[model samples]
Target: MTKSHDVSVQDFNDEDSNVSSNPTFESVLNARLSRRNILRGSIGSMATAVLGTSVLSACGGGNDEPAPGPVPQFTPIEKLSFAAVAKSLEDKVTVPVGYTASVIYALGDPLRAATADYKNDGTDADFENRAGDHHDGMEWFGLGADGKASLTSVDRGLLAMNHEATTDEKLSSFFLHADGGKSTLPRPAAEVDKEVNIHGISVVEVKKAADGKWSYTKDSAFNFRLTPWSDVELSGPLRGHALAKTKYSPTAVKTRGTINNCGTGKSPWGSFLTGEENWVGYFARGAADDAARGDKSVVALKRYSSVQGGASRHGWETAGTEDKYQRFNNSKTGASADGSDDYRNELNTFGYIVEIDAYDKTKAAKKRSALGRFAHESAVFGKAEAGKPLAVYMGDDSRGEYIYKFVSEAVWDAADASPASRIAAGDKYLDKGKLYVAKFNADGKGQWIELAMSNTAIAAYAAYKFADQADICVNTRLAADAVGATKMDRPEWCSVNPKNGEVYYALTNNSARRVDATGSQVTVDSANPRAYSDVHKAKSSPQLGNSHGHILRLKEDAAGAAATGFSWDVYLFGAEADASTSNINLSNLTGDQDFSSPDGLAFSPSTGICWIQTDDGAYTDVTNCMMLAGLPGAVGDGAKKTLSYTKADGSKLDVDTYVGKAPAADTLKRFLVGSIACEITGLAETPDGKALFVNIQHPGETTAMANIANPSKYTSQWPSNAGYGAGKRPRSATIVITKNDGGRIGS
Candidate 1:
């Protein structure tokens, strides 16, 4: 889990520094309230009454607010009666006794009729029409016979799934035996092509049978794959910027494809927004790039961890001299005016939120650069008011990164809700917006600081001179630093409660944030409170950092999504049952609810039940990564508590914060446990909530590339035991979960 797709590699083993301070608490709060009428009611009580709605959706008196009516309270799940499944180390998918889990789709499954079945012998080659590896984030789009959107069409629909990364050893043959087990040499063309084509999004059609079973519709007209070879256009403010110009697109309006797509979100206009996270590691930089760009460019490159002479994990540069392969090389290899003869500018084309119209295969995907570039995880939408601007919340998924928000310039119009093309509506709103980074304070309040070129602080910063709006958007991390945004601990997936509109984010483990004798390390802040030790099996030394991460909740100002000020609190502190101290387990979690490295988070749109999935290496020795279903209460449902933990050296650490109520077995229960060395991620449910879809990524990941040929040596054989049969290598897949009695899931 410490390793990832890109060069920066800020996984569990990596760390970053350079967090700035926030503005005075009183000033930001006062300025936020000044823009709107002060609430006549108690803020805390009002926040409690409408707990499930996000910060922006619960407030009143705004022009976009609905006509006077009682604000509905979220109807919580009455009772969870299914028994919690026990944690297991067996290489099989385990669920409650009354539930059934089956593999719906697996790697290399053909999406088209002409394609042959996957041989599972590593010799199949129709990757362009087959499923991909490492399925991450996904969404279900309802489709009718007329090819129109329908919210309740559960029997027929399209699923847009993101293939985050590829499996080097399992997916290809002979890559391990070539060059005497060394992959440094030039890889075979076929092997490289297979890997490249398997690292994007897959749009497939699925249908439910009369028995309520789900299966992929192979060869359906709506099924297709968007691989690294797909052509995608650039839209928004930076589309024609000089920095984006290259040999591939001299006019700077187009790019090749999307890579490292991790977490994803569906747009309000019905398009899919797949985030390009960890794309930096996919490009190789020339050794002399730093000298050619000068000192300023080097500083910016270092901030993003774009090493001047670094090589990618897949060695894609050694594949060939063809433009398709050479685009992976970011070196200035050609001698032409404006670098038009080379692919030096190719890396800049990535690290963005790409929009795809799944219903229309004729249109090219658009990379909306106005959303601001960083290591984006998920781009979740806040509540959209009728006449107000739409707001999108996103997190930069790297250690010690900041959270960001994008406010569209155009106001929401009811007429565009069911447009002929969702991509057309995206051009109207997503292409023009203002991007802001968050600045959290010690007093449980935060502000969204604008990262525009016109901001006085940003323009005056000496580190990197601000040229224009495009410049600021490209170097978002640097602008965030200059504006004094709060540095978080690897902010991952974000979800807005549909019932109340409250927002929640998962801050994965941070192996940094300890205080040194000289005070050079990142100190404890109100947000990043815990700094302790957790045992790591790889090293003899204890891991000194926030191994068990936490979850955060936010409530925006009365003006809703576009509001500048918001209130925040720590919702849950992730810890094991046997942590060094009781205080570290601030939520007072019991056996059924405890977990670490909370990675994938999603709230049921129809039921308001929050689903938490773990991608952990911290406590895997005790239990494999798992998924839990929870009925989340309001932000202030519990009283303030202090978390204290003692270090190995006997020194004690304590943190004071507002924690959620301790959960019982009935409120929070383990739903599923994955196979060995796998991450449980990418959850979705149909509108009726009768079926739940979850992805199992990289099973048997601990298998070394040298021993990939032997199935018996594999660390995991999941889906094999769950159905796929024997003598098969462990493959990542999406499994469908349903109650045996045909009842609604999680009830």
Candidate 2:
């Protein structure tokens, strides 16, 4: 396939300038291709073919490329003690020297007077209205001295935790039945409504004492829960598109609650943006339904991955065939072509960043369409520059996906903070913006190719015809592909340095990558630098797959949002040093920092500190997943090294690499390790950095439901019985960590 051609350079001032002047594919073919002139080059089949050939050939001939240097090692620091002590016997949060932690809130924790106290034995009938399961990402917002929420206050605050998904089988005892599925049982609408109300987000007011310990107020007025069934509105380009229309809200401009809120983002105006990922898979559709709706195209089928052959995973489909359950189906079942008979447009309602006004509970949530539709991991904004458009970067989370960035149309305004101001800021800045996908070049330099509708190559794509700006925004991935964006290895959560504005992406593990082309192997590229197989037995079962993951970093051009060029490098490579010489442990990682699947990432603005957390099944043997604190220097702070590996065919492949390094003890230290059978995810800090909040998700996950009630049979009883039977079922929770001396974290 040839590389997508770049459009001609023109004056960037035309608001109505079509990135492509022609609307029809035939019109694009008839357009002139002026190679002699730098500004008007047209992209055709030849350009795409050449680009594909170059990419494949570049990976095939490994000898021509320079080899990366040897992995650098770091000193190991003393491991923190793993103590199982707290007010509750089930608590299992860990802390480094001079620090302590406490469980502030947990699954099913009550947030309002309407909800009853949590019955720790899983017998709570009111749990449907309580908090959901598996807390992931979170944020801290301060309440002002005047009793209103303030974005800048440093003391009293509200903690907004995302209740990602649920583990409960029934909404209440009344819904329980002999069969494992919900189809065998029936429940009241009130019960179903409660389940819906508990599945979104939990906002609880928390305050820090003079001693630096954080705790929730018993009757905090700001405490509230935002669930999936709540009413929400749309913002940005495709807000009122025909594809977004639904029965509940015919305008398609309004919908209900957020789902699969994995990672979190905060707007400059002080609101939280929760990303809805893996949402399409939640809906159920009939296999033969798409053909009836005129949306049976292969693209549409693959995009929605309609579950026509099976029922919904969470059993929400059996909640009654009312528009509620029917809305979950992406297949066409109705008689009309007006989207009145079926809920095929439901899939389009999600996948965008759902913005929430944390302070103003009355404001409706808005899904910002300008951010693009994909499996968004998180939306992180760079430090705002006066007169410069705001920069927001996101990762597509799926294997072999691309990272994207959106630059706002409006300049930064420091005075925007209230709910009204926040909405105004989003409308002026996020609604109309330029989106660009990343392309990592061979020479450690990368470029941001604009995926504008005006681009001629996008206008001519045969896969799906692009009509206007709405088409470009809704079908963003296709447009990015048309512009030649580099496919990466599971690009997950992204973090930008507050001081330097450099971007970092967590490229989680890809097991399909191959050392050499075999029928089952995935060919390695520059972006996905590692290819290896592992033989290990997980708690679930024995398996062979790529267990270790890596991190990639890029520096923006001249510290500006408009910069097209950037320098790139591999910040860290995930591996076990004892495994093989070819597996480079660049951080000179000991068993402590040798983590698999680096997921959640955050940087402290006060000290420029970087905290890395893990969500893995690979390195669980060494210990439960852990968290590490690092002081990152820059994109290219380490030396250019070379790496050597042997293919399955007994041939050697070598390539040049860049890996970061620092004193093992001081720079790359394993600050804490979690309890048994848990993944350490999510991180947040107080404004002064005096305290830190960490989440421990699904402890004792390996335990079977049959043995859940027996403490001796379970691998862990964290946050309940640190030693023996604590009666309470294991639940995920947010732990508050603070230093005894009241000093800033990582200081």
Best by TM-score: 1
Highest-lDDT candidate? 1
- Candidate 1 lDDT, 1-747, residue by residue in tens: 224322233232243534334322221211000011111121111110100111101111112212223322345575577777666676877777777777878887888768877766666788888888888898988765456666656566778989888654322322212221335557666678878888899998766665566777776777888988899998887798876888989889998989888888988888888998888777778889877765465666677777888667567777787888888888777777566778777877888999998877788899989998888888899987899999999988887788999999999987777787899999998999899999877667789999997888899988888788887887888898888887787898999988678889999877765532113245556677666666655557666667789888888989898999988887778887555434457677766677888888898775677888888877787678898888777676777665554433556645555666777778887788888888998988777677888999988777666665777877876666566522367778888787788777777
lDDT of 2 by residue, 460-528 (tens): 876677777776777777777677676566677889876577888887666544445334333455545
Poorest 10 consecutive residues by lDDT, candidate 1: 47-56
Deviation in Å, model 1, residue 570 alpha carbon: 1.6
Candidate 2 Cα lDDT to native: 0.62
In model 2, where do residues sit more than 4 Å from their true spots? 1-91, 127-129, 168-195, 210-212, 296-298, 417-420, 517-521, 539-546, 646-652, 708-711, 722-727
| TM-scores, each model vs. reference | 0.89, 0.83
RMSD, every candidate, angstroms: 10.0, 15.4
What TM-score does prediction 2 earn? 0.83
lDDT of candidates 1 onward, in order: 0.74, 0.62
